[model samples]
Target: DSNFLFLFCYSTYSNKVFSVTFLSLAVAVIIPLFGAIILLKCPIDPQPISFKEPPVLTGPLEPNFKLRQAERLFENQLVGPESIANIGDVLFTGTADGKILKIENGEIHTLARLGHGPCTGREDEPTCGRPLGIRVGPKNTLFVADAYYGIFEINPVSGEVIPLVSSKTPIEGKNLSFINDLTLTRDGRKIYFTDSSSKWHRKDYSLLIMEASDDGRLFEYDRVTKEVKVLMGGLRFANGVQLSPSEDFVLVAETTMARIRRYYVSGLMKGGEDMFVENMPGFPDNIRLSSSGGYWVAMSAIRANPGFSMMDFLSEKPWIKRIIFKLLSQETVIKFVPKYSLLVELSDTGSYRRSFHDPNGMVASYISEAHEHNGHLYLGSFRSPFICRLNLKDV
Candidate 1:
């Protein structure tokens, strides 16, 4: 009887064990298969990006606290002063709400409007206009690059905004998705600008950078001919555009690529392109010419080591990138904002001149532009509600 009972119990337990084992195996296989299917269905198409390793960020600015102690001029009054232009004692900057604000003696006034409607947030950018670049052209005419409205020429005195080019307008059969930073030639015969991304709008900048999109481009618009030409294509989040002091070359910032490229506009190398500076520590935004004979580049956010490094590694894996991008929210994609701020100076030949850093962002962060005027450096930001001013002597 004892042998029979033991045999019966073993039979019942083995049957249950087989069922459990089978279920566990099925789940183990099906879970991964399901995930694979979902990933395959993901729409976040990404491409590979390869470049030389970045240089060491070390410099004389190891502990420089310049930006942290800088002065804030228009605190909490404006939103996203993306670029700066100075005429005499007056400062002009573009805002997120499609308005160009003029600053004089610390007072702020609206200079022009790019759109007809009020933009309360990013969703209304198309309707309300978001000006990303501003420059003072010939005869004090303000050139603005609105993300949604395309290129514009604003009369600083009359507050009149004229659309020089619409975003819907196509160049070389390609329409601009985001018209970004702009610069005008000395003789005012031409204007150069960047289209940050051909696949995403200004509000989706996080996605654009994360995806490492190569749809960004550099363009030139001839004022006399009213013709637009694509000077460079297949760029990675192309941003700020500036011409060489001698007007022989144009520099375009490829933000996600962490580099600047020079397109020869004149001289023997005319129509050729080359790297100006490579392997930057952060995403390059607007670059401006300094009164001291070099250029100042605003490093929007310093690349966060470990985290950003991992992302860059994953950028090469298309399948992994698609899944991660599909699951990540826009805020989470851009949540890696570094607390540090930076402004790097380079010679006209693209050699390093100097660098300034704010390790804690006590004074400013996400600075998009740096302009030198009257011995003072006025800084703009993509998100800061104020423009910061710093003394060149102190720096």
Candidate 2:
């Protein structure tokens, strides 16, 4: 629109001039974004998890966790939801189908298709395995860390998806098959993310214990240098990656282990990592710090489905695991049914502060994403158009 746009179009990101265009807003409206940037640096003011004496609920009526169907958007299914990012009022989520969604005012719409593949019927096989992590920034920039295609950036309004970082360079597809959550540093100089597993894609979660591979890793991408560096290596399903409100520490969810760990960025414990919460009631999928305080943790499933848990128990027998997987893969006539419930909300230490669950399997298993926007918690699935919204005030 103006020369001011071209002259400063590619601002330095990571290390180089990346693809984002930053427009200074009267300088007054910039405060909030700046405040969010500051969130990336506050020292890790961790509320230690007293494991020796885990907190317990002493009351009868815990918040009811139930899932009531709301509405439908597409006839297809969802993969794992890695991270849910809110931009303004639009809630954008990335899916296994290589697509990102723009949920506006309670209506569903596709924001951009990041990659392609067969799981969701896309022509390009590599782009379609699954998309997990997504974040929206001040200028409406959408950054996504996909399971198969690595990392991507998109224009929320135009559907222009760009490959920002892929396993092509330092890390290869063989190294990062399940690229998980991602976050931008407060200064926007570095982008951090995780690869949940090297041996398991969303379809192969059953193999995590079977393979026992030392694969999960955390990485930092420098835009200015166009280099992606490893921060933490060898994790148990490196699932959720979030920066502390102060931007001083990075919190990562080890879903396969049902615990959240904090990696310091700046502080007395820089480079140190410790447990924030462990043995979540269920497998922790993703975590978001609420504007009002407290983190919303989504327990992907209260427990692995009986069929899957059975496989875990029979791990010594590979043939049994294989046979069961094959059977359950085709167990349904309609391909899916509302069978179980997955709820996520505030957790008071080891206690459940409040939760939302939708059984009957309507919400499905292997929930990849969950986030809280305003007072409503949104859920994205790995199997159906299982996008859901629950009123968090009930908690």
Candidate 3:
């Protein structure tokens, strides 16, 4: 009897120990899992992607490897030259380091610095400076869109920078953030720009793209009234803006959607937006008017292989996407990095004319905007440390 009682007591104790150990292990694993979920705070309201049509593939006449032969102008001197403005023989651009630089007489000069600190990397963006969009207006005023500093007008010749609008300017009771690209009306009375993501700052652009949130907005600032109006909202990562040659419409690049949206500025369709182009071969960044009577649309990277289907598959599974956010790094999660360079030419009617691809990314990759000036294509990139120049006539 004594031996049986002892055996029973030992069995009970061992079972309790096993149960406690299992429970502790489960808690240890689950606590961090839950913590990560809250920390990510992924708010992805994914839009439906209709794959009824895909962007046209490269044609026989399309310049594929030709872009690889481009000359690296201003080599390694600039960082993230996002957009360009040309005046006479001078080319002005905004760099990732928050400085407006101009290249004249084959020499690069600092026109103006938006921030006071030295831009060592993206982490110092707030102190260092990051200018994204640049446009030249009447009287030689350069309109600049600083990702962190709102909008400013600078005199390129005098190196004088004047703050015109703050990124925090409220529209319909909401404050603006991530003021990205800007375009001036033909009359120069108003400035149209895109707030890339109201939810994410410029540093967290990868997060914004991965989350695929519709937090992007478009606005217009009146030079005379000194008022800002939200022209359109709920854009999925609006990046670039350009007015039509006739000023009748404006094209806004929806980066996440990989297409362009046209907003009618004048005419019966004024105040309305339509899908200008859909299912682009790659993610389009900036659209600029070309002297050749077409538009130069820059694609940051070509969506290839698994990337094309992965985004579609993940967009539907927010739960899985949250896990991906928790597990993957920005460089690993974002597929639209500096893998390929694609420049697309489109007519005023939004028809595809031709495409130029540098599959190897030898000369330029991650292009943000390509402006054609004086028979040459001046390329801007959000990832490259140099601006690219390609002779269009030779191609």
Candidate 4:
């Protein structure tokens, strides 16, 4: 299937012992690493949605008017495409499939893979560890936020792999679980990353909501000082940290709360938090500040299930959440109408001045981090393999 984004790990990458014993029970959802498939009922299939495109805005964009998708990037489906940045004339992508791909003009190239090349077609058992956010440094090195392995940097020229951080036992005793997204400081002296949850897997979204206790955190790793500091914590899935264009403040999105909070680094509000944007339509994932000002907040996907917005309250009651999980966890196919608008919030007051969206399900999870490179608007999708240049005029 061309749309085989979520493939069975056991079907391709199982160990010797696993292949011999767990081969026959195709009925069970065999987790390749955990081996023992937890017995569960079958899931339902959801119908694919079709979206409508937004109208053309030819003026200084209106904060008050409605908007929709201006252009569609790569078609079909790709998984978890994160941050998008450029290295000279080349474009690169870090995917949930554990691969980093290079793009030039409008063509695709396999830059490198975590365990194998793009064409090696290796079966999926957690090889590259799920590459998430990716950014190119000044020296042309690619830094990636890997799910299980922590932060990593790969030499774009040499294709050499280097580990920047991981959860291995330190000289002391602690664990950094699920390092999700990342960004660099103005001078590139520090790396700021998000640890989404300590006791949950990315696929188990329901469990994360049930146990949400503001467990996510923002960590800063200084390259020159060779130090790591816990900048902020007790956050509900702290995601999408971006350095303000002038390097004055760092803005982070709390997905569970559907809001972005700013931590001032060089202003009167230093060491305090200010509201950036609140009551967003979707769960915000990664956000980037534009060169001109304002930030591109990637609302990964809008909240459909009512429980998504009230995670804090839901986490307090174990029995209530468990009952809901048990009832809804059976479906194989999950469906929802994509939220039809994306806002370009103002940097000063976090007010929406411009927006984009559509009526169809033209997007999905962790769609893409929006970036204003040069004078053009480039749209990358978390679920699509290609990058696109949009003809969106200024609002």
Candidate 5:
């Protein structure tokens, strides 16, 4: 009886162990299989990107902690000052909450609101209206580019807001999706702007970068005739627009391509397109004409490793991007990117002059535009709560 009992107990223990191991094995296999199936069926049809080898950081492109010396203005009081424009001494910027603000004498005032009320949080950006780029136009009017809305003209003193362009306005049978930045002609008669993408909204910018689609375009709007003309198309994530010092050509930042493109407007090369700069070490955002004869380009992020960055890795692998988009939300994916701040100065000929870096983003991150005014560089960001200010003499 004792021998029989011992054998029965041993057999029961063996069966239990086998069942546990089998269940573990089945779970491991099924989970991966299900994941693979989901990844294969991911909805995003990411196009494979052929990126040029990023330029190595050396000489003027070398990294430095110079940006760490910047001082935060209105820290924790403002949110997402994406672009900066100044009228004399007073400063103007557009914030994430759909408001155009005027900063004067260290005081913040709401000059105009783009969207209607009840903007509770970031999720309401589409409805709340996110204003990206702001420029001072004729008669001290503020021209704003709202990502969700279109272009707006505001009188700073009267607080009067007028709609210049509507997002619903179709160009070439396709509506403008993401209206990013704008620059006014010397006489403020023509407004040159960028449409970032037709497929993605401003909030889905991460997905746009990951997809690397060439749906972006550059446009010119006649303030008098109310006519819009497409100057250039097939841009990959066009972010910034600036007129040359002589107004002979326009420079547009192709963010995903890490380059700036030149489109001749009123010269012998009219209607001609050429590369202004290429293979930048970081992704360029809003570009502004420097006080000198150069341009200030704010880099949203930098490639910590030249050829092995997360962007570089995903550039050639569409399937990997598909899998990542399938498993993670856009916000989460953006958060995974390493933080770094950079601003570069390029000569009018597109030659690199110098760069400022906050290698670890200790003071500022996600700098979208660097506006040079009155011996100071006013830094704008799409993520930070405040703007940064750096005296030019300090650098």
Candidate 6:
């Protein structure tokens, strides 16, 4: 009886081990098979992106918690104030809900509605009209670059909206797909803007960055002549547009490449292009002229960090990006990116002056632009619901 009991216990143990091994083997085989099938069915055609070595976070590029001191303005009252423009104390910004709003004395008022009906969320962005770059144009007017509907000239007082450039307007034999940021000349006659992508709309911007296609174009528009001309082409996710104080050369932020490019508009190198700043510590968004005749570049994503940067790692690996897109949705893929807020100041010659950081993104993340006015910096974001104001004297 003793021998029989011991044998029975051994038999039971052997069966349990066998069952566990079988389940492990099955999972090992099934997971790769499912992944292979998903990779094969991926729709994205990724292009190889050559990214420079990330800059070292030393000297002026060192990380800090300065941005944590930023104060929120009109918190939860609006959403996605992506760009900010102002005349004296009155501030103007475009919100995610397709409205151009005016803020004065802590009051928010609608100046103009670009799209009809109620905008429920981001999915309605294409139809609701996502306004990106806003600049104070000639005669106290506002020039807005709407990602879906093209550019418009809006009267700040009466809220009159006039279409300056249509999305259907073709330049260089191609229709504009993603009209992003714009900068006007001193007289606001000639407008320079960036078309972010030829294949993706504003809503699918994440896909454009993952695909890393060089289909972006920079354009020059003459308000008087109604003529639009392509200034530079084949840019990778071209974003912000800013002209130098002298208006000799214009700078465009190539977001995916983590660099700023200089295109000569009225210099000895007219019609030529060169690198303004390369291998930034993060992806640059909108660049505005600083109070000291420099440039304030807003970084949407920090590349150099202790944590993983999925976008930075995928920059050189197109096959990996294809697999990621196949297995994960756009929203899921974006979740892999770490959060951080950063802003860099560049000299007139593109030298790094200094940088501000919210390394943990406690106060703000995905800072889009920094506009300096009256000893303060008004910050904008594409993801944050409210704007931030940082006192320059304190920081």
Q: What is candidate 4's lDDT per residue for 1-395, written digit by digit as tens?
A: 53463355544555655766576554354454324222332221111222122223323223232223345455444444566778867777776567777767866666666544332221341345667778877677988887666787788867788777774433123356557788886567788888776655454443454445476777778877867777777777676788776667778888766777777766777666677776665667778766546777765455433323333334345555444544565132133323333435455567665555433434322355676676655665655554545444643
Model 2 RMSD in angstroms: 26.2
RMSD of each: 3.8, 26.2, 5.9, 15.2, 4.1, 3.1
Estimate, for each residue in 21-51, the C-alpha lDDT of model 5 and write its tens digit.
9999999999998778674655467888777
Greater lDDT among 2 and 3 belongs to: 3
In model 6, what lDDT does residue 366 have?
74
Task: Tell me each candidate's TM-score.
Answer: 0.89, 0.70, 0.85, 0.71, 0.92, 0.92
Model 2 segments beyond 4 Å from truth?
1-63, 69-83, 104-109, 117-129, 172-174, 304-339, 344-352, 362-366
Say which prediction, candidate 3 or candidate 6, comes out ahead on TM-score: 6
Off by over 4 Å in 1: 1-43, 60-63, 304-310
Q: What does the lDDT read for residue 272 in candidate 6?
A: 93
Model 3: colliding residue pairs:
none
Candidate 5: the clashing residue pairs are: none
Model 1 residue 23 distance off true place after TM-score fit, in angstroms: 10
The CA lDDT of each predicted structure is: 0.84, 0.61, 0.81, 0.59, 0.89, 0.89
- Candidate number of the best TM-score: 6
Across 218-255, the per-residue lDDT of candidate 1 in tens digits comes to 99899889898999999999999998889999999999
What is the lDDT for 55 in model 1? 58
CA lDDT for candidate 6: 0.89
273 in model 3: Cα distance from truth in Å? Answer: 1.8
Q: Worst lDDT window (10 residues) for model 3?
A: 47-56
